[model samples]
Structures are given as structure tokens and as C-alpha cells.
Target: MQDYAKLRKAVEMQSNEMKRIHDVHIDYWKECSMFFSPVRGRFLLSDKNKDFKKFHNIINNTGLRALRTLVSGLMTGVTNPARPWFRLSTPDPSLRESYNVKIYLEEVERRMRYVFQKSNLYNVLPQCYKELGLFGTANLNIDEDFEKVIHCTNFTCGSYYIAQNDKLEVDTTIRRLNKTPRQLVREFGLDKVSAPVKSLYEKHNTEGDVSITVAIMPNEDRDFGRAMDKENMPYIQVVYEDDAPKDKVLAVSGYHEFPQATPRWEAVGEDVYSISPCMEALGDNKQLQHEEKSKAKSLDKMNNPPLVAPASMKNTPVSALPSGITFEDSQSEGKGLRSLYEVRTPIGELTNDIQEVQRRISSALYEDLFLMLANDRRSGITAREVEERHEEKLLMLGNVLQQLNNELLDPIIDRTFAIMARNNLLPTPPEELQGVTLKIEYISVLHQAQNAVALRAIERSYAFVSGLVGLYPEARHKFDSFQAIDEYGEYAGVPSKIIKTNDAASQAQKAEQQQQAQAQAMEMMQQGAQTAKDASQIDTEKLQELTGA
Candidate 1:
């Protein structure tokens, strides 16, 4: 029973402004869905199960298929749930070698992997990827679950409205949830719910779910320097009945961090919402749909055309089947039943045109960029050619990868870590490193793909330097072979245990040098003793006599 009037007003006014821009996004997203994700979002609760029949106008299905490929590429390349994709490290490189620091990080990584696997993060990530590529933005909610350690939910695009701070980070989210009265009573408890909803729950009403709007935003008025409470936490979540009286709130809660992660593919100038890859080919998709429809109609007309019949045969039946019999006037010789006119569909050119459009649409979505490596079946495709194509893709995906890191992957890790730490689920860290800021290093397949390019460069340089050694042996000394080995191992995502630290390597080299020095000294001593023995055997006296001394 907290008075959240002030906070509620802020959400309402901001939501109105958000709605205007959100509507603009809806217009574009709806068009994109016609060919890409036809039934993805509820979209104002317009209808269900009808999208495939109504707006799914693609005859080639190339757009829909390309969307799937993009999702798979992102999942495997960015954050493959099946494999360990990210590592934890301190900002200070020197601390990374500390046994305590290294051990703590390893334990943390292990726990994180376990939690993500135990949760449904991987199950819902594909839909999040699809929404990002199709709508230019997507939302993911991460919360703590006592049973699962962590929980994740992916919200359909356009179903929620979002606002950002000056830094363009999403700090506030308003979502319209459809929940049954029984669900609401079970979730927030009957005492905290609205009377109408409570009555339904008590009466066992079988009516449909109620639409409730919940807003999570920054609690700016609280003193962040002090310990956080539900009222004084960093972010507040308010749930109010939709279309009910003002201040008809169901529940008010808070969180230590913003739980929603809104990852955008690419944002336009000063716009909160993003413009997706789907928009690039929207024109082509619409035209392709039109062309295919026209082709179908033309073929139908060519096969089943309107008939021309004389009045004498107006009452007669005409069978249009393969070989049908029709009784016509016995004396009618001029005409019986004939086609109204000829239909030259020109289906050949039309088909080719449709294919060209299909190719264009696929290219717009960057389908060829990903499929080239896996789908190419041509002979004589060299490894160098594949590497060059991979490099090209890396260069093109540079901005996209960076954005995903900044907006998606980074936030998810930070939020998950925060939740785990609060529940005391992580391992203890070194006393000195408690206040140290940790950084995330992405080793996902996508990131390694980028690193793979650098690996090639390093190897090529090493080979070139080695080739020069025979001509100018000093060239070998100029190359930092030790540093090169370390760099190569890192880029390959080789575990630290497999690669020795610099200190260990330097010590090994020094020990080897000392052993060589000892061996050389021992050899010199042995040779000196042998010479003395020869002298003792009177070789010197024999030499002097031969010299007539």
C-alpha cells in the first residue's frame, strides 16, 4: 500500500510519447512481417492463426528461409549456448596471472555456464535473434529464480514500449501482459490485486485473461549511496490494471538493476527504436509478392478462360474437364463453345523476374554472406578464397558485432552476474580484487571468427620472417617469437592451462641457458684433464728430444 502516484504519472506521460513512436515502428514491422515473421507478435490483439493465410504472401518463401538462416548464424556465431562463449577477466592484465584471481574467474565462469544451461536462456534466444534481425530491436527479461537460479523471457517486438536515457541505453520498459484472474491472484497474491480480479478468482470465473500494463523504470529520487530496499532500489516495477481507474495499481516492486535488455541491430539518428535488415528489402518483398500473384492468375486464365456461346446453346452445359462431352445444336456449324480470347501469359520471363527478385531480397538480408561458406558446392574453391570471403564478412559485420556486444551480450552477462552475486551463488574472490572491475572477453564463434583473421596475419608474418632468416639471420632475432606464441594462443581461444604464462616461459628459457653453460664448462674441464694426463705420460720430453734440446 505504497503511494506510487508520482512514479505512476511519469510512466503514463512517457508511455504516451512512447506510443506515438511505437506506432511508427508497428507500421514498418507489420510490413516486414508479411514476408518474414507473419505471426510473431500479437500486434494490438488483431487476430491469431490468420497471419499465415492473410499476410504470408511470399510464394518463394525465400524471405522466411533467410530469416531462419540469420537467426542460426547469430546464435552459433555470437552466443552458442552449447559451448562456452565468454570469459571473465580483470581490467588489469597483471592480476590475470595471480593464482587467486585466475581461480576465482574460472569458478565464476563455470557457475555461469551451469546457471545458463539450467535455465531456459538457450530455448528463447532464437526468437530474440529473429526479432532483432527482423524488427531492428528485441527485448529480453532476466530475473532470479530460486528453483532455476536464473530465468529469461523474450518479449515479442511491438508488444512493449521502451524509453532510453541520454546515453541511448534502455532504462525504462512498459509491457502489456495478458494474464487470467487466477494467474494474477496467484502471482501478486489476492490481497494486493484489484477487487474485480479478486472476485473473479474467488468465483472461479472462466473468463479470458486481463490485460495489465507493467512499467519498470529508474527510481531516480532514491539515495543510491545507501543500502537498497524495495522502495529505495535502483529500479521500480509498477503493475496497474489496463483501462481501470487511475491509481488502480496491482503491485509495486523494485530491482537492483534494470532487468530488460533491448538489443537493437542498428539505431538511426537520435531514435530510440532501430531500423532492421528487414527494411532494406521491404520494397523487393512487396514487389515479389505482387509478381507471383500475377503469375498465378495469368496461368489460371490461360488454363480456364471465359467461354463464348451462342443463344442456341445458352441452355447447354459445357464440360471443361480433360475430355468432356457437350451436346450442341445439330445444325450449328459456325460456332459451338469457344474460348473468349487467347491469353499469352509470358510465364517464362515472369518466372525469371521472380527469381531475380528473390535473389535481391536474400542479398538484402545478407543471406549470401553467411551461406557462402557452408552452401558453396562449386569445384576449385580454394582455402584462400574462403578465408578472403570470411574476412570480407568480418569487416562487414564489425559494426553489428560491436553493437551486439554493447547492447545484448554485455548486458545479459552483467545482469546475470548481479543476480547470482546477490543470492550468494558465486565463489569467493581474492580480498584485494573485491573492488576490482572485471571485463568480459567474448570468445564466441563469431568473435573467434574475427580473431581467426588476425591469426592468419600473425602466421603469415612469422613465415615471412622465418624465410628471411637464411638471407639475413638478424631478422630472426628481430621477431618477438615469444610474444607471437602468446598472441596466437589467445586468438585461438586456447585455455590458459594449455599455454604457459610469460613468467613460466622466461624461467624455463633461463634454466635451459644455465644447463648449456654448465655442460660447456664440464666439457672444457674434461679436455684440460686429458691434456695433463698426456703431459704426465712424457709427451713433452719426447717432443724436446726430437727438437735436439
Candidate 2:
């Protein structure tokens, strides 16, 4: 038996530490809050009421729009609009008949798609984008029903720890669950159990709500006891008990492993949460935009300066001035007169400054690339040149793409596979593949582009080496044509079904050679028979000549 109380306490302590770490990056969270909710943004809230009202009246909200576009573009790239985000592979090269594995994986993918669709993952993804943009991290929880698996994001989900050995893998996770006592009883299947369980459920029903913290972690012992059954082959344990009912454990269940991992689209240094530094730039841009509007308003006022008159003439009707026939009183003939003069608002420099600030904000968000493409299109630039430029810009996101592959796409795929396996929704693996583990290969456009750089380098190397080998034959040995082709196929996202296995290719070559040898032997036999026939005929001719003489 495990010490449930002690373990729970330790997990709680760790969760508190993680929360403290999260609090340090609260400024990033504030930025996200401002992006989504301008009225409630901390910046706006901190200003005086009158000043905030002015900001509200003139706020452009271009920053929010830019952030939205950036998030959408990133989501589209990573999710792979053309096809699935990932494919399955195996580490074992010795395994032949990968076509069967492919079929199995395809079925699994189809099932996963069904579950995701049912769970409205399309809706959940936007929440992920919001979390990633603001906090630089997103969490997904997989919950199962009888018919389908549900996937959800827990942006506010708290208290998770990752193993020190692997930064990418999460070791343990805890989530707060709110439920009524009766609901808990039903969930744990305690309604039909002991009288004490029933009484406890009734007592909780009288209360308003109950909160339970469920913790999932790896099992410490490797013993194959009753608790370590085949159903829980991966040997992860789950423990849950009501905070109110501390003495009595609610339930203890099993899982393949902890079903949560922190997926970050980007990171800075070693921090768990690192938002885009561009957010600060966006805030500055907003402020500048407000100031520019204020200056423009002042300039307009200066261009049509307000009328000023002497105290005696102040009582004169303004309608008389608008009629262009102002009549001064006889007593104040020349003393009271209105003068018209320009205030001279220097707006040329201010306009230039505003444009520069806008440019900086756009560059920070990568909107400048889009603007460049748009301008290039108008200029009738060739498609090839535009593509080259776009690719060059994409290089800046190479690290982000890699992080998505490892932290987000790969884990989602693995967890989806695990869910399908647990539900028996996938086809049974062949006997030979019983112990084989599947690996994920991302083939999205973004992923392919990330590999394109290395592929280009390999191509260049091969070209140079082949040229050298033309002059120096020994140089040919330095290149491995087969390995090059294999790598090219992988980087190019070539389908495995189209490529022949080494063993299969060798077998085909051997068969062709045997057919050629058999043909040669048959030809030799026919030629020998013809020669024999000719010799017999010559012998016959000689014998006939002899008999006639």
C-alpha cells in the first residue's frame, strides 16, 4: 500500500512551486488579457477615468488584430491544412511489410479524427492558441467516454510537474475537480457499496459543493500483482480523495501514464513560460497611436483657431461673425476687435514618427513579411523570387517549428494512439510487431520546409562530390548514393509504400539474374543441336559419295 496522504502533500507542494514560477511571468499574462479584453486591460484600468475614456474613444485596436492574425497563421501552419499533422513510423529498420503497419496507423488516425471531431477539437484549438500566445504554454487533458475520447485544454489547470530526465515528458499531473457529493459517489461507483459510503454521499448532498484533487503519477514498484493487471500494463496509478473526507480514500484507479504534457510553441532561455517580446512593442504602439490621434486633433484645432474678442465685444452674437458682418459698438470703436492668426501645428515630423512606430510594431509581429509579399505581387514579381523570399523569412521560425513538433504535435499523436489502444479502437498489431513502438513523423508543409534547408545542403554536397569523382574516381567511394536517396525520401516526405525495401529490391535483382542465366543456357542447347544436325548431314553426304564410287 502507498502512503496516499504523504504523496498528495508532496504533489501539492510541487504545484505551489510551479504556481510561483507562473506568477513571475504575470506581466505576459496581463498582455494577453489586454489583447483579448481592451476595456479590462490592466493598462486601461490603471489610467484615470477621464484618460481611460479618451483612450477608449480613440483606441485603434490594431495591436489586437495583429496578434490575432499571427496566432491564426501559426495555428494553420502547425495543424497542416493539406493533410494530417503527423504520420506513424517505427524505429526498427529490420521490420519488413511496413505497409501493414501503415494500414494499422491509418485506421488509428481515422479513429482519432472521429474522437477529436466529436469532442469539438476545432473549438479547443483556439483556446490553445490563446494560452500559447499569452503564457507560452498549453496543456491538454484526455478524458474518455464509452464511445469516444474527449480532448480539452486546461489553461487554468494547475499543479503539474515534469520529470528531470526528459524535459519534454511530464511526470505527474494534478487537476482540481468540482462536483457534488452525489456526483462523486456516482463516479466512484460507491452508491451500491457500504452504508457509510451512502451516508457520506447523503451528507454531501446537503452541502453545496465538493472539491477533489486528483493526482496521477507513475507507480513506484514494478511488481506484477493483482493491481498491476494487463488492463494497466503501463503501470501508472491514480489516487483521489475528497478534501473533506480525508480519512477515507474515494478511489484508486490505473492508467497507461500521466495524460498531460506542457506544449510550448516557443520558449526563451530556460523559463517554463516565455511570451513574445513583441507584446511590449504592441503596447508601445498603442500608446503612440493614441498620442498621434491627440496630436492630430490638436493640429485640427490649430488650423481653425478659436475666436477671441475683448470683454466688451464678448456679448456680441457669434451669428453676426458667421454672417461676416460683425458690428462693433460705437463706444468701443477700435479697442475691441477679433484677430485671425494661425497657431502652426508642426505635423509633418509627427506623421513621420507615427509611421516609423507602426513599422516597428508590424516588424515585431512578422506582419512586415506579409506586407512585402503584397507589395511584391503588385510589382509583378515572379513567383519563384517571392517564394525564395518567403522561405528566407520562414527560417526565423525554424526553432519554433521544431519546438511544436517535439512539444505539441508529437505528444498529441502519442496520446491519441494510447487512447485508441486502450479503447481497442485500433486494429490488432501483427505477432511480429507485438512489442514494437510506433514513432511519429510530421509531414506538414511547415515541417517539410524546416527540413528543406538540410536537404538543399545535402544536394549541394552530392553535386560537388560527383563532380570531383568525375576527375578522381576514388572520390566516388566517399559518397553513399543509397543513403542519400533514403535521406532524400525521408526529408521530402515520400510515402513508404512507394519505396521498395532493401531486401525486396535485392530479391528482385536475384530473380532477374536467374531468368537471364536460364535464357543463355537454353540458347546454347539449341545452337549445339543445330551443329550436331549439320555434322550428321555432312557424314551422310560423305558416306553416299563412297558408296557410289
Candidate 3:
């Protein structure tokens, strides 16, 4: 009979504890929903550039520290003698340990310092907690008074486990198999914990069947363990259908809730889910959730109505909801607003990467076309041959680009080149000209060097479509087929100019030599005439002198 009475008391105590815990958990979820929903909604379409830095900074600066603080607080609330809340109670003669708080706070501060050192936020946010070391050491003595049996090894730097052993030395097998809150509290100290608070940890259980057990503790004060006044507690209430599949519970688990122009709760009395309350409590803040809500609301009201179905189709179902209406239907009809939104193509894994390479190659091909055609007026190569050469060069260029794209430079090259092209820095093909056979060849020196030393090979070849376009401007209208080529061969401009200058110089030299030859021929003819006259006079005198002798 005595045994039965004790059993009954234990059951009653367990029941009350469960009820309180259930209420606390439900409230926590409500706050979490309120905090995350608005942030998510606004962040989806927010200015990613402006807000991304701040968001990243917060996580970098405070992530580990905040995690540690909440974990430690939960441990303390369980071990505190005034209100032992976890499944187990503190050991006998357990006293509220002041040093423990200081210790946990110090650990938190230490983590914050480490986080500051490791993250970019270290430069942005001023050092508000500089003496974290001293503060953490000072608090180390706070939990010494508690009757705690700690199972730990100092050799393994951060592997200690603490638990309230009032009932018995904590079941060693249970502690080894699964860590309990009491065990973690002992090891990490009540000052700084590295685990999630009990309530958040329990919710995590519903999402993933992880073996991690939560460490529960009572709130230190009625104001839910926060430093602020009860009235100032920021809480957003939200309601949303939990459409999560039983198999995929974590799909939306870590969502934040925050208040904005569009309140986290869709309607106050409509039982909508909200993230605002949780954001207020946890300080997960955003600037643009507020801006977008205001913008969306104003844009909806001031915009003219969209187009409707023709009056001839009055009886059609399409008339009830305009065919073009996407966001709204009834009020948007007959306004003739252009549809600015369109469904985007789902990103296929292959196309996203390969397509970027193709685009770069395509741009280079056009540049090659202009470069080759604009400057190739003197090559003995025929217009048709030039066209063939362009085709060959383009093919070669495509191959090189494919190689570059495949070289595993996807992460850096794809995004970087995309930015360059979008900003119009990439060269484009010039308009095709008539009667010009444009040969465009794109070659990579690096790749070609491995095969053979192809010196002065046109890297990017651009040419006018037809040779006749330059000789006869009338053929310009017939010109077409301009393209961009890859960068593989040497530029053709300087070489072509050198050839033209050389030809002109050779012609000038030939003309000067002809004039000098003509002048020498005339002088020789005049001298020959004078010599003939002298010779005739001498022959006649010799004949007379010979006869007289």
C-alpha cells in the first residue's frame, strides 16, 4: 500500500511537468513562426545586395556565441535548485551557483571573440566585448556550489559531460549511448553550452530522427529569461497550414519570423502564422521586409487594371478571369497592363554551365568576323577561300572554347564571364558587308602550342561577308553572315598593314629605277651620234693622206 501511494505521487508530478512543458513548447513555436515568416516573405524579393552583407555579418559575429548562451541557460534552468525542471533533479545540497553564470557568460564571450576573429564582421561591428577572457574566467566559479558529478576527460579539449546525479550517478550506459541535458551542463559548465536550448532541440527531433536529446531547464524569471521588461517582449503570432510531408519534416524547419510592413501574421484574428514575434525575441532582423510590403501594397493600388477578354467572348469562362491575369484577376481586367512576369525555365544542370561557355565562344566568334573582314584587303587568299577559312577558324574556336569550358573552371569562369558579357564589355560582330568573304578563326595559343608552333596564326578572324562589298559598295546590301570567333590566333591587323606598306614601297622603287634607265639611254644615244661624226671625218682624212703618200 505504501509503494502504491509513492507511485501515484510520481505519476501526478510527471503529468504537471508535461503540461507546463507542452505549453512552453507551443508558445515557442508560435514565436518562431512569427519571427521567420515576414523575413522569408520580404527576403525572397528583397535587394539581395543591400541586405546580404548585414545578414552574413550577424551570423558570422554571433552564431556560435548565441548558440552557446542559450545552451548554457537551459542547463542552468535544469540544475537550479529553486526549480529543477529536466527529467532529473540536481544532486542533494545543490546550491544556486553564482560563478556558473559568470562562467557560461565568459564562454559565450570567448566564442564571440573567436567568431569575430574568423568572420568578416570583425571589421564591421566595433569590439563591444573586448574583455571576454576575464569575464568568462570570473564566471567559472559560479557553478562550483552545485552538487555535480562530472564525467569528463580534460585531455579531449571540449568533451566533458555534466548531469545532476541527485538520484544516482547518472546511468553511465545512457550517458554513453545518448547525452542528457544534465550531462552536457556538467561538461560544458552552466556558464556556456554549445547545444540548442531544450525547446528548439525537441522540435528538431520531430524533423529528423536524430538521437540528440535536449537539455531542459525552467525559465530563471517570469519574463521568459530575457533581459528586457515583459511589456517589451517582441512576439509575432502566426498561423499557416503545416503542409509538410511526414517524411520531409525539415523542409521548412529553420524558417525565421519577423514583423514588417506586411505583418508576419497575415491577419490579427485570422490565426495566420507569423515570424515577427520570434524575430523580435531572437533579434533576427531585416530592413527590406518592411520596404517590399509597402511597395507591393502601393503598386497593387496605383497600377491600372490589366487587359480583359474581348467582348465577343463574354460567355467564355476566360472572361471571368482574364487569361493574362497572374497575381490577381477581378480588379485587374480591362486595364491593358503589360504582363511583366513570366514563368522561368527550370535550370537544367548541364545547360547552365555549358551554355555559358557556348555564349562566350559565340561572342568571340563575332569579334573574329569583324577583325578578319575589316582588315584583310591584301591576302592572295580568295574571298571564297577566306570564307572557308573563317568557317574553319570558327570551328577551331568552338573546340577551344569547349576545352576551356570543360577544364573544371566552371565555378570562377562561368560567373565571371557572364558578368563581363552582361555589362557589354565583350566584343560583338560588326554588320556584314557585301562581296566580302569574311573568314573568322578563333584559336588558343596555349592549346596550339602543345600541337605545333603556329606563329602569327590569326587568333580571332573577322571578315566582311563578301570582297565585292568593299570594291563595289552596291553589293553592301547583299552582305550578311557576321560572327564572333574565339581568341586563339594572332591579330591580323598589323600583319596586313605591313604587307600593304611593303607593296607600295616596292612599286615606288620600281618606278624610280625606270626613270633613271630612260635618262641614261637618252645620254648614250647623243654621245654615240657625236662619236660617229668624228669617226667619219677621221676615215676621210686617212684615205686622202694614204693616196698622197
Q: Model 1 off-target regions past 4 Å?
A: 45-56, 224-227, 327-331, 376-385, 529-549
User: For model 3, what is the C-alpha lDDT against the true structure?
Assistant: 0.29
lDDT of 2 at 79: 70
* Predicted candidate 1 versus true structure: per-residue lDDT over 253-312, tens digit per residue: 899889978989888877998888888888888888899899989998888888888889
Candidate 2, run of 10 with poorest lDDT = 41-50
Error of 3 at 218 (Å): 13
Sort by TM-score, top down from the best: 1, 2, 3
Model with the higher lDDT, candidate 1 or 3: 1
Instruction: Tell me which residue pairs clash in candidate 2.
Output: none
Give the count of colliding residue pairs in each prediction.
0, 0, 84
What is the Cα-based TM-score of model 2?
Answer: 0.70
Off by over 4 Å in 2: 1-15, 36-58, 94-119, 154-254, 265-270, 277-283, 303-307, 313-343, 369-387, 390-392, 461-482, 506-549
Candidate 2 achieves a global lDDT of 0.61
The TM-score values for the models, in the order shown, are 0.91, 0.70, 0.18
> What does the lDDT read for residue 338 in candidate 1?
81
Residue-by-residue lDDT tens digits, candidate 3, 491-535: 211112122222345578799999999999999999999999888
